[model samples]
Target: MFECFLEIAFEAEVLTEEHPELQELARQLVHEDPATRPAAIQELRDMIYERGECAPRRMDDAFLLRFLRARRFVVPRAHKQLVRYCRFLEQYPELYRDVDLWGLARVGCAYEGCMLDRPGVGRVTILRFGTWNPDDYPVEELVKVGMAMMEIGLRSPKMQVLGGTVIVDMAGITMKHVATLTPTIAYQIVCLMGLAIPCVMHSCHIVNYNWLLNTFFFLFKRFIPKKAWKMIHFHGHDLESLHQLVDPECLPPRYGGTCRHHATIGTWFNKIRKYRDESFDRDMKEFGWVIKE
Candidate 1:
């Protein structure tokens, strides 16, 4: 299964009728019927106009589709999520401040966006947060890094449809790191991922867990919803167990995988920047994240 995907070559593009495989997958997973897509999108658009509280920056088919797919083509639910998303971003002005590729890399979280062979897992995002230093890197900046990665990854129609898996490596996490997660920050992070983001969160795999990580999760469990909670799997130092859900061939050596490509922050950011279009800058404007050349 792993080798089968390696030959396909990942080419990021917006969802279209040309991609029958992905379209079929979207239909099966998210109840997206092409014949009814325009109607659904318009219905959500109408709701947006009716509410008048959360108007999208751009009301194109692509942009609205993200919210629609996240809610499984349910227009009302998608409209609600969009409202929440806009409200959340408007509320948290600080999370988007002073964020860029350099600052994010210094936070010590490496992110890699790659196509996967597995069904239901279109893209794999490997987030290594063990090297994070609370003293030097604030939790807010870390959140910015996450938002940046997600924004970049979601540009791919494949990711929007098949959804993606988040691998959280907590190997070098310490008590100090755990302490930085204030109750407010915890709730915000939960809302950003679980509620506001118009991306399909298939599942999250937390590996290399420990007591300190447990302490952080104690605060997290309160803010996290039960539905999202069910998608999370904890693997305390068991790479083999992690491999059961995710194909190790896509992972690096650190996670007991044979892949040689390291998902360093610089590499990830650089690639996204190179591949990013104008929307990348436009999207970050709300958070004041300007991509400097």
Candidate 2:
């Protein structure tokens, strides 16, 4: 592994603060005697039910486990995060109101959005921003596509527990692309992603990015919650380096990696578009939420 690490050459490691103590907390949540586990879960549930005054969709033991895992299985932390997630959707319905899955897929195709075939540990995503013209599709739309992708990811049991990585390709970024990022929308996007989403973001790698990308961080870094900062990595313009961290087999040909079939942004887009069109009405509803009257 050390030799392999040197070959592609970048120092991107998963440095999340899933601390030892937190791991023990999570272990107890999952491995406690089956008899005792129910009560602990109930306690977590009551915190949500009594305080949040909302009942989110699919809050089963399995579902709650995802939250517990994300919050390091600390009941209060998980409860607070869960409440924020539900309330964000309810309060900002417009953001999700007319959820355009087809548009999302289209933009995603241009944005190079696709879940990788990483079978062992968790779901990993590679999002190529430079794949298409940002002028053709606004960055705001691209951000929404990301949100839609997260929603799509969580629908799977594996991703909910194991979480995922997001690779943002920056080769195509130009002044046109950067122009779309307003402070307000930028604030909204990160907060929505960093806080409101229930899925655990194992890590994110920013590749092929140029100097312009740093301006984004400089402008809005404060807006992002601190915990997420650790998950981000910078791998400037080097596919060889990225390939070190992510298997080349998992990447699309455009990225100087081996993945060919259904790998490009457009390929995944068409697949989703076709499926969504085939079942258009059924699948594109506003996201499910939990709120009390």
Candidate 3:
């Protein structure tokens, strides 16, 4: 009975409450108190109904939990975040138009690894942003693809409680790629990550960067908050530095690691597709993702 217009779902295996370990993590990280959880959710629901502005398609516990956990069970902050999320989707119709996995994968630049299961690590997302060619896929499409991946990751309760770690591979970036990220685009992306999205960003590791990439990051740095700025760690081709923060055993060989289970666009697409709900397509149609048969 999860009626999410956002079209995101928790992973199938971990969807149930059978895993007490994750439930404990939720209590520790997100302050999910068993006694007060019901009251908080009801307060959020009442706030949403009172405002009636940009409310989600459904206000079920499952959907509201994402926001609640993100805001550390603060009813008012969660409600505000929910509104911001809904408004972001409504405002950016053009960016999400025709955003499909098959079409985006065909661009040959959306490289992402799997959600790592190492005990100490959260969900690690490896985004090879430098490999993207602006000619093939514009910045708007890049945002669309990144947003899609994040939306998929949000379905995991583990991802919500444990939060996320991002590695931005800046190996093949050029002025052409940097120039494509206009100030407007940078501002919008910053806002999406900072406000609209409910996911907790634990850390962001940037590898293989150069002066060109530094210039590129400067565009986004001004838009980023002081607290969020501290989360970004820059490593210009120094994999060892990245290893100190992110476990080297979890990374792939190209990033100076020993793991080979990294996900290509096609493999990751198929893997998540297996766990995707039947209603995903119907719910995502508004974002212009029509599955071609």
Candidate 4:
């Protein structure tokens, strides 16, 4: 059951990036045929409810106890990236200590938009953490990836470019309000899709991607108009968590309602060994983080 949830979560993340509109479609599908879609939706809702109530200390522990006896391994590319990133951190610990790996990756995505070097391709804004040091992560690598993505966006005639950077302190915000403020803050910082600007929040730590994404999606789908375009807040939580949380069912399954899916316990643990070791290796090799031998 947990494994199923993880699969659903992963699918959601992939769909969010590849076909965001599918989220809306999925919701509509549920509404269009409650008998089928709602069943799936209920499954997701049940899972989160249990998760919140149980509050497993770590996703890995939950996975190990509930799923397969052993855990899975990491993909080669992810391994390489993890090793490289770690090496960079070790080489420049002072700068990278507080730098969020996930945040850097997300910033890399935004940078992609800027590099497109096209007209009206949208803006790239960085919300500054007053105390953060750029040296922590591979800022150069981030700049490189951001530029590459931007170049891709520029090639598209339909997408224009408007770019800038914004730095703001995020110390006072409550966890509950994080989702609501994310897009609102982005809109304040940059000129997004003309309806509601698209923005990503680069934060150091987050409680749970499922909870956060669920909250953001609910608010986004409900209050924001149909024409408005805004991405849910992005904190570089574990990639696996992001994958798990992206499911349409993870949200309230229906707009003004609660979820009904059963929590997939121990599913994440099945892949922890692979994710951790591979992530470490990828950080060291690809991002140049130092490996502690």
Candidate 5:
């Protein structure tokens, strides 16, 4: 996640530096009367390219690493919100694990007035949300929201999803028929995407004799992919309140090679563990993971 954030920060900075004129044009559009800005910006782009100006420089990995290191001491306010949200998840594992934690983080960060509103930072924020909950919402909704947020972050931009199929129908379809056929069609569609539905189990965690964890686990299991289930890193005081997902003795047999850590995101966490020592420790402490430093 940190690496992804750094990449976006560098991209934003590089784009701005390479295209100062474009950036100014975008600013002008924002300041102009709404009706004229769109066309004026288009005209500006054409005029610039016609003059044989060099294309903007693309963001590279080294630049991003440097930017992140430079900004290391000045943690974004949004990051603080993210840490708080992660701590919340640790405390109430059942309530937050499957509840769009990244979405909650993004909203929390936005509300907290983070510099993430700046170009590259904003893209990093979106990408983090995407990684945390790739399938939390419908694809259509994700595309719509993601595009809007990207526009806000990348100032002068066009979003295009290449090499993907899109089907558009203008025919007026009745709501009842569309609703009736949607699930069946959606099920069929998954086969085309080369995916298989995995087995899911309904389990619960009991915290303080309360069934909150169990209830949340049920909902989370429904929304998230089975393979990514272990991304929820539990912490906090009420271990007894939480429910175990699977019995150690009853572990499922794997047909192929498998690691002890099954989830991809969990694997990523392990890979970046060294780089995130401070952030990880701070998060752990905040979430009641009482470890002696």
Candidate 6:
């Protein structure tokens, strides 16, 4: 199969503070009254057990809470969402088919990076929009790989429970790249992050963006939900200012942080690529079609 290289630092001391709401949700999922529990929750559980399908190691009350909270604990809607999540895995292998893919799809980690996790802010993510090389990868591949990155992040323990922050570096972007930000991609990204993936995006920082893209970005904002719209922040080119939000210690050298090795983006790419094929092969065996029986 494929591979995965990133090693999550599970140091208990590094974990900052607990997310009270999520802790309470975990409490409710286990201790709350069965009758008061939404019917859809039980139905989804029944369906999973009935199929005898094996869930991944991390699929616990925390995972169930994502769906429940997404639909606000409603029975029917939650049921539909649960079904959609499974079916999406079954059919949309190109996109939703990730559990089946080894390293979250064959997508490269060009535009995404994760490894920086802080306590209160959760998982610190980097979107190197400056690394966009359309010649190397097309739009379709971008969407699929991008979704894979999101899935990987959600699977992370801290991100799944405490939520996370995203840093979108806009340093090198121009009108040439704006074409890739199609309406379909924008809408799908919003829906994917908000619905399919359950991590709470606590904040999104836009650093080094040239003011010229404001009109385009403003138009792009219309397609996303108000919840996501509120999370986005523009920091322009000031890395020092950005450091106030994300500590310099958490960032790469280019951004004035450290990756324990080289601070350049190339090192970052090299780091994530190590797990590439291994993750793919193992995922297919673990979550693919035969397991459905």
lDDT of 4 by residue, 1-293 (tens): 85576455323311112244433432332122223433333443345355443332223321211111000111222223223333433433333333333333433212211111111112222222312334454334333233222222222212211222221223333353343345433332222212212111221113223434454344334444443323333444343443243332222222121233322112222222223344344533343333332
Choose 1 or 2, whichever is better by lDDT: 1
Give the Å shift of residue 179 in candidate 3. 1.4
Question: In candidate 3, what are the lDDT values of residues 1-293, reduced to their tens digit?
Answer: 22231123224422423266887878888889878888999999999988887758667887788899889898898988899888877778665666555565654545666444453456666777677767775788777666666665565677778776778887888888888888878877765564688877777888877888768888888888787878889888887888898887778778777665556655555645655565565545644665544
Q: On a 0 to 1 TM-score scale, where does candidate 3 land against the true structure?
A: 0.85
Q: Which stretches of candidate 4 lie over 4 Å from their true place?
A: 3-248, 252-283
- Model 2 TM: 0.72
Name the regions of candidate 5 deviating beyond 4 angstroms: 1-147, 150-213, 237-293
- Give the poorly placed runs of model 1, Cα more than 4 Å off: 1-21, 97-103, 108-118, 259-262, 278-287
> Against the true structure, what is each candidate's TM-score?
0.84, 0.72, 0.85, 0.20, 0.19, 0.63
List runs of model 3 lying over 4 Å from the truth: 1-18, 118-120, 192-194, 282-288
List the pairs of residues colliding in candidate 5: 204-214, 205-243, 206-241, 207-241
Model 5 TM-score (2 dp): 0.19
Model 1 agreement with the true structure over 116-177: per-residue lDDT tens digits: 43566656677665676666757777777777666655666766777777787777777777
After TM-score superposition, what is the CA distance of residue 170 in candidate 2 from its true location, in Å? 1.1
Per-residue lDDT tens digits for candidate 5, residues 1-293, read 75566444334421323333433433332232235534443443443356433232222322221111222212242123223333333333432122321232232211111122222111111011212222243433322222222222222231110001111111222332233323323332232211211111122112122223343234334444455344333323333222143222222122111112222222222233323345344433443333232
Q: What is the C-alpha RMSD of each candidate to the true structure, in Å?
A: 3.6, 9.0, 5.5, 20.6, 21.1, 7.8
The candidate, 2 or 4, that scores higher on lDDT is 2
Cα deviation in Å at residue 204, candidate 3? 0.8
- lDDT per residue as tens, model 6, 1-293: 11222333322212333455545643333233335555545665665667544342334554565565445465455455555565445445656443333332334434544455554455566666557677665655655655555554444434554466777777677776776777766655554555445555567788877765684476468766676667777777787877787777667677777643212233332443444344433543454311121
